[model samples]
Target: MGIYGALSTAVTGLRAQSFALENVSGNIANSQTIGFKRIDTDFVDLIPDAAPKRQTSGSVLAQAHSTNNVQGDVKGAATETYMAINGNGFFVVEPRAGQADGSATFSGANFYTRRGDFELDKSGYLVNGAGYYLKGLPIDAATQNISGSVPQVLQVSNAFLPAQQTTRVNYELNLPQLPKTPKYQASQSSGSELLSATDFMTLTPDQAATTTGAATTAGAATSSLASAGETLTIQIGATSRTYTFNSGGSTTMPAIDISDTSTDTIGEVLAAIQADLVTAGATGATVGLDGTGKIAITAGNATDTITVTDGTSGTSATGFNLANGTTDPTVATSTALAARVATVTADQTDDFLNQSVSGGAITVYSSNGAPAQIQMRWAKVNSTENGGAERWNLFVLTNGNATGSGTAWTRMGGDYTFGADGSPSPAIDHTDLPNLTVNGVLVGDIRLQHGAHGLTQFADPNGTAEVTTIKQNGYPAGEFVSVAVNDSGRVVVSYNNGQQLEVAQVVTANFNAVNQLKRMDGGLFAATSESGEPILDNGGGVIGSSLEASNTDISEEFTKLIVTQQAYAAGTKIVSTADEMLQQALNMLR
Candidate 1:
C-alpha cells in the first residue's frame, strides 16, 4: 500500500513540476510579446481518514488517517488585467486607394489582436504589416467626424494630390493720371486792334460856282479872275505841298479835289501799324483806299497823322478827323490755364492682392474697380488621381458681394495637373460655378477641400473658410503668412497683408477598446471586436503626443515561478515518504 501511495504521490509531484516548468517557459518565451500576460499555478493537498475521533473516553485507539499533499486543481491560465487584451476584438487595417473618395473605408472583419506597431503607407494612411487596417471613426477630408463606426479595414483613398506646376499668376496696379493744356493763335486779324478814321466836312455854293482861278495868301488857289482855260497852281505849308486846277471849271478852287491817302483807314490803321512795329523787322508804311472811298496810310504809331487843304479862295479850310477811336482788345493770361495740370497722389492703404498658401490649399482675391475672387487649391504630390487636374479659377462678380462668397464661386481658370516627376501642367479652363452677392459688397472666400478621409473645413473659421475683404484704396500685395487646421480636417491659411484666410485641420479617431487592436508586425494596430467601437475625439484631451507601451512584468512572473517550484518539490516529498514506509513494511513481511 505504501509503495502504491508512493507511486501516486510521485506521479502527482511529476505532474506539478511539469506544470510549473511549462508556466516558467511560457513566461520567459513571451516576455517580449506586447500585451502578453504571464500565468500562475496553485496546489492543494488530499488526505484519507478511516474514522472520526470521538470525545467520549480518552479516545486511546483513535483511527490513524492517511495524509497526502497532491495537485488538485489545474485551472486555466488567467491573464493580467493590466495588459491590453487581445480579446474578442478586431485589428483595424488600412488600404491605399486614389483620391476619388478622398477618405478611407473600414473593413468589417472582426479579427482580434494585441500588436500596436504601425506606420504610414505610401498613400499617407496608418497601416500594419499583416495588411489589416486599424479601425476608427471616418474623418472628413477636413479631419472632422463624419461617422461614429470604428474603422476596421482602413481603406485610404488617395490624398488630394497637389498641382505640380504653377498654373497662373494674378496682378493689380494703379495707373497714373494724365495732364492737359490750352491752344492759341498769333495774328493781327484776331480783333486785337482799334479803328481810327472819320469823314465830315462843309462847303459853300458860291465857292463852287466860281469859274476863273484865284490865288490866296495862305498859299491856296481859287477859280474866280484867272483867264478861262488856264491852269493855276498853289503851294501850302513850309514844305511847299501844291495842287493844280483848271480854270473855267465852274468852281472857285476847282472843287478843291483834295484826296487823303493812308492804309490806316482813318481809324484802326494806326493801332495795326503800332502792333506791327512792336514785332521784329517791320519797316515803312503803305497807302491804300478803304471801302468807304477814303484814302488811308499805315505808319509806326498814332502820332503819325495826315492833313489836307482846299485850293479854292472863297471856301473855309476843313480838317480831316481820322480817329474812329475804339478801345484796344486784351489777351488772356497764361498762368490761369496752368493750374489745371496739378498732380494727383494716392494714399497707401490695406488693399491685399496675390494671396497664396503652401503645404495645403487656399483662396485669394483682388481689390480694384470691382472686387474679383480667385480660388487656389493645393495638394501634396502623392495623393491626387489622374494627377492634380483641378487647380485654380478666377471669379468676377457683378453684384456687390465680396469676392468668393456664396453662390459666387465662378471658376475663371482651368484645372491643372501635377506629375510625380516634378512636372506641372498648365491650368485648364473650367466652367463658372455661380455668382454670389452680399450687402452690395463683393467678398472673396475660397473654399479648399481635403482629399484624405473626405473631411471638409478643418481649418480655422476666420482664417481659411471665412470671407476675406480686400480694400480698394492703396494696398500692398498679400503674402503667405501661416498655416492652420480646420474642423473638417482641411488645411487653413493666412496672409501677411490680411487678405486671404481659410481652414486647415487634421482628423483623428478613437476605438472602443484600443487594447483589442491586432498587431500587423509593424507598430500599427488593426481594429477587432475586442476593441470597442471607434469614437471621434478631436485631439483635445486624451491623445496628443503619447504612445501606449507593452504590459509585461518580469518580476511578477519570476515570483510566480518560485511558488510553482516549491509546490512541485513538496508534492515530490509526499510521494517519497509514502514509498519509504511501503519498503519497511515489505521487509517486515519477508
Candidate 2:
C-alpha cells in the first residue's frame, strides 16, 4: 500500500466528492418543491484490517442520507383541498396503474408521501400534482362516522344526493313574559294585553274551585289597636310576598294600613288586603266575604294553587278566619277546553295574529324533497301578574293560502306553563307534532326537541320572542358542486343545495425508521424492512388549505457545492502528485 494505494485512495476521494456534488445539485434544484425532503451525502470509511504498526488511512465512500424526518415550513395555499403534514407522518397514496373505460385504475400497492398538492381530479378522485391518488376511509353520510379501517383510493361521486325527510327539529327560543301584541295598548289597564285563555276559549273555567274561610262574625269588636306589627304572607306557585299592616300604607309592596281595626269596617280591611295581594303579582284574584259573612279567595287562572299564611301575631289573618297553621284548600289543575278548536280558521286568522306574537319561521323539507316554510307564533294565555299561572300556547301556520273555512294556524298541543323562575314547570323536553303538514305539503309527524331548558319565558325589553337556534335534520336533493378537506382531515363535499356532507376521512401513515425508507419518484417513499410497516393512526396532524415547503435550504446547498468542488480539486492534485512520483521512480530506474 504505497504509491498505487495512494493513487487508488485519491481516486476514491474524487468519486466521493463527485457524489457529494451531485447531491448538492439535486438539493438546490428542488429547493422550492412542495414537501420535498433533501438528500445529503454521507462519507463512510472502508478500512482494511491490519497490524497496529502497519495500519493505513482508510478509503472514503459516499452514501445517500435522507432528511425524511426533517420538517419544512408550512405555507397557506388558495386551494381548499390542498393539505400539509404538520409533523411526522406521510399521506397514504396509490399510483394509477392504467385507464379503463376512460376511468383511472389504481394498483393496490401503497405509497407514502409528504407532498400534499391535492386537488379534485375530473373523475372526482383526489390526486396530487405528481399523479398519485389519495387513500382514505369512506364516511357514512347518515351516521357521520367512518365506515371501515382499511383505506382505499377516495373518489367523490358526483351523483345526485337523494332527499332526506325531516325527522326532528331542534328549537331553542325565549318567549317574552309580556308579549306586546297589536291589540296591546300601554295606556289601557285591562283587556289591552291579549289573554289567550279567554280570547281563544282554549280552557274551561273552573266553576267550583274556590277556598272559603270561616265567617268574620260581628267584627265590631276592637281587637288590639295595631300596636304589635303583624304581617300576612301570600304564596302563588313558588313566589312568596309578605304584607305588613301599618298605620300608613307605605312599604316596599305597599303595606296594608288598617288605621284602626275598630273604626275600619271588616269590608274595608278586606279590601285593603285584596289590593295588597294584587300588588304582590296575583292576577284576577277575588277576595271578599260571601253571603254567609265567610271570607272567600279564588284564583282566576285555574292552574294556579294559592296558599295564605297568617302572621305570628295571631291577630292579622285569624281575624279573617284564615287559621294560623292551615293552608287554604284550592284547585291545583286547569280543566281542558271543553269545546277545543285545534286550529285557527281562516276567518279567525286576523284575531289570532292580533293576539299572538311571531315566534319564528323555518323552511323544512318533506319526504319527496318538497320545501315548505312554516311560521310560528306564541300566545301567552295567563300571567302571574294577572293572578294566574304563566302559561302560553304555540301555533304554527299550516296553510297561508287557505280560504273560507280552511285552517290558517294549528295549535301544537296543550298550554305550556312556566314557573316563577321562568323555566317550564313541566319541563317540555320534547313533544310530537302529529301529522304536521305545512302549506299543503305533508311533513309527517316530527318531534320538536327542546332538549333541557331549551325553551324559556323571561322578561324581554322588546316584548318579542327571541329565537336563538332553529335547525332541522332534513335536506332536499343536492348535486355535488365541490369538495374540500377540513382541519380534522375529513373530506367534505359541497352540494348545489347549500349542504356540505362529509364523505371521507384522510389517513396518514407513520414509520419507525423514516429515513430508512426507499425513495421513489415525486417525493414518494416505499416501506423497507428497515423502515418497518406503516403505522396507520399515529400521524401528527393533517393541515388543510396549506402546502409544506421543501426541506432543502438553498444557501446551505450552495455552501456544500463550493466545498465539494474544492475537495474534488484537492483529490485531483493528490492524483497529479502521485503521477509525478511515479514518473520520478521511472526516471530513477532508467
Candidate 3:
C-alpha cells in the first residue's frame, strides 16, 4: 500500500508541475494583449497523515491566481476613444447579442473589462475590440447633467440641433477713461434723444403787451381784449389742414379762441390751444410750458411736426409766433431727438479725433435660432470739457432694410451711459428694439449684463476695445461636426455652430476583491461570489486617448518559465525513480 501510494503521489507532483508550466506559457503568450493581467501558479502542499515527527508528504496541487491589482504601462493612441484605467476600477460593459442593420445590438446582461480600445459603431454605439459595448450615464442636453444613477449602453445621435432664441448677453470690457468721440458738451446728463418732441424758441416781448408773447422765463401774461381783433391759424404734420382762431370768442377744438381778459397767463393760453389741437387729431403731440414760459410740444417720435401761426394781434401777435410751435417739417428736424431727452447734448461741438470711440460686433441669435449681427458702438459723451471724468454713450444697432438717415441704422434702444470707471452704473436692462424688426422678423429684446464691474476705464495705447468676455445663451441650428471622449469619461459632441454638448458620461465598475474575478476571453472578467458585487466608481480612473499595456513582463515570465521547466523535470525524475522502485519491489516479489 505504501509503495502504491508513493507512486500515486509522484504522478500528482508531475501533474502539478505541468499545470504551473501551462500558466507560465499562457502569461508569455498574452504579453502583448491590452489590459492583460498575468496569471501565476500557487502551489499547495497536500499531506496525508501527520504522526508527530513522521508525516508523509502526499503531493502538490497548483492553482492559477491572477494579479488583477497590478497596474500596466499606459501608451498613447491615435484613436480618441481609446481609454486606459489609471487607478482601481474597470469599465462597465455589455456583450452584443448580434449585429442588425449594421448596428451592434446589446444583450442587456452586464460584463466588465479593462480593455478600452473602443470605437463608434454604425449605430453610434461605442464598442470595444472584444464586441462589448460601453455603458454610461446619459446627459441631458439642456442641463448638461447626468440623468440616471444606473448606467445604460451609451449611444450618440447625429441629428441637427434646433435653433434657440437668445435670452441674455454677457459682456465684460475695459473702456478708456477718455472720450473716443465726444458727442456731448452739455453740463446736464446725456439722456436718450427722442424723435417726436420739440421745445420752441424762448419767447421775449413787452411786459403788458408782450404778456401775450412766449417767454422762456416763468411769467403770467394773460390775453388782451384790446387786440382781440387779430386772427390766429395753425397746422400739424407734413400735410395737415390749417385751423384759424379768434380772441374772446367761442371755439370747439382745432378752432380755439383766446381770452379777452388779462386773467389767462401765457402758459394757460398755450396749454388750452395745444390740448384742442391734439384732440382734433391735427397733431399727435403733447404740449407743455417750459421753465422759460415757452411752449414745448412732443409727439414721442420723429415721424410728425407741429406748425403754429401766432396771430399778429393780442396774444397771437405779441406772445405767440410761428417760432413758438410750427408744422414746418424741416424746422425741428435737427433738434427732434435732442429736445425730448432731459440732459442730452447731442449737439455738442467736439473734435472726433480727440475723443476715443470703440466699437465691437457680435452675433446674437433670435428666438428661432436665426442669426442677427449686433453692432455695438461706444462714443465718449464727456471729455476734457467736463473736467477729467470719462463717460460713454453706447449705441446698439443692426443694419435695417431702410436707406434713409433716420431709418438706415436700426437703433436698438436709448443711449446707455457708462460710469467714470467705464462700468455701467445701473447696469443694462431689457432694451427693446421695436424698430429693429429686420424686414418684419421680430428679434427678441436683448439685455447686457456685466459681472463685478466687468467694464473698466483703463488707459491703453492701442485703443484696444477688448471684449474680454462676450457670450450669449443662444445658438443657431447646427449640424454634428465631431465627437470625442474626455478624460472625465464624458462623451463630448461638437456642432458646426461652435457649440459643444456633453451627451453622456462613461461609468466604471469596481470590485472590493478584484483578484477574485474569473478570467474570460479578450481581457474580460466575470464577477464571482469571491469577488464583491460591482460598485459604481466615479473616481475618474479611466484616461481617454490612451491604452494600457499588459502587466506581464517578458523577463519575469521567462524567469518563471525557466523555474517551471526545472520543477517539471524534477517531477518527471521523481515519477521515473518511483517507477524504478516499484519495479524493484515487484522483482523482489518475483
lDDT of 2: 0.78
Ranking by lDDT: 2, 3, 1
Candidate 1 Cα lDDT to native: 0.32
Clashes of each: 121, 3, 23
Error of 1 at 467 (Å): 16
Residues 95-180, candidate 3: write the lDDT tens digits: 88887887677667778888989998878888888888899899998899888888899998999988887766787777655332
Per-residue accuracy of model 1 over 37-145 as CA lDDT, tens digit each: 3344444554444445522111111111111011111111221111121122223334434345655554344443333333345554444434544444444533433
Estimate, for each residue in 1-590, the C-alpha lDDT of model 2 and write its tens digit.
Answer: 88999999999999999999999989988999999999999999988789989888879999999999999999999899999999899999999999999999877999999999999888999999998999999999889998999989999999988899888889889998888899888887643564444344344322222234344543533133132366666564444666666564333343555555533455665566566566666666666666676656555555444666655333443444353221211212243222334688788788888988998888889988999887989887666555456878788999999887788888897768998888999898987888888988999988888889899999998889999889998889999888888889999989998899999999999999999999999989999999999999723599899999999988899899989999999999999999999999999976
TM-score-wise, the better of 1 and 3 is 3
Error of 1 at 75 (Å): 33
lDDT of each: 0.32, 0.78, 0.64
Q: Least accurate stretch of 10 residues (summed lDDT) in model 1?
A: 175-184
| Model 3, residue 181: C-alpha shift (Å) | 3.3
Badly placed stretches (over 4 Å) of model 1 are 1-10, 42-107, 121-125, 129-132, 148-150, 161-547
Q: How close is candidate 1 to the true structure, as a TM-score?
A: 0.32
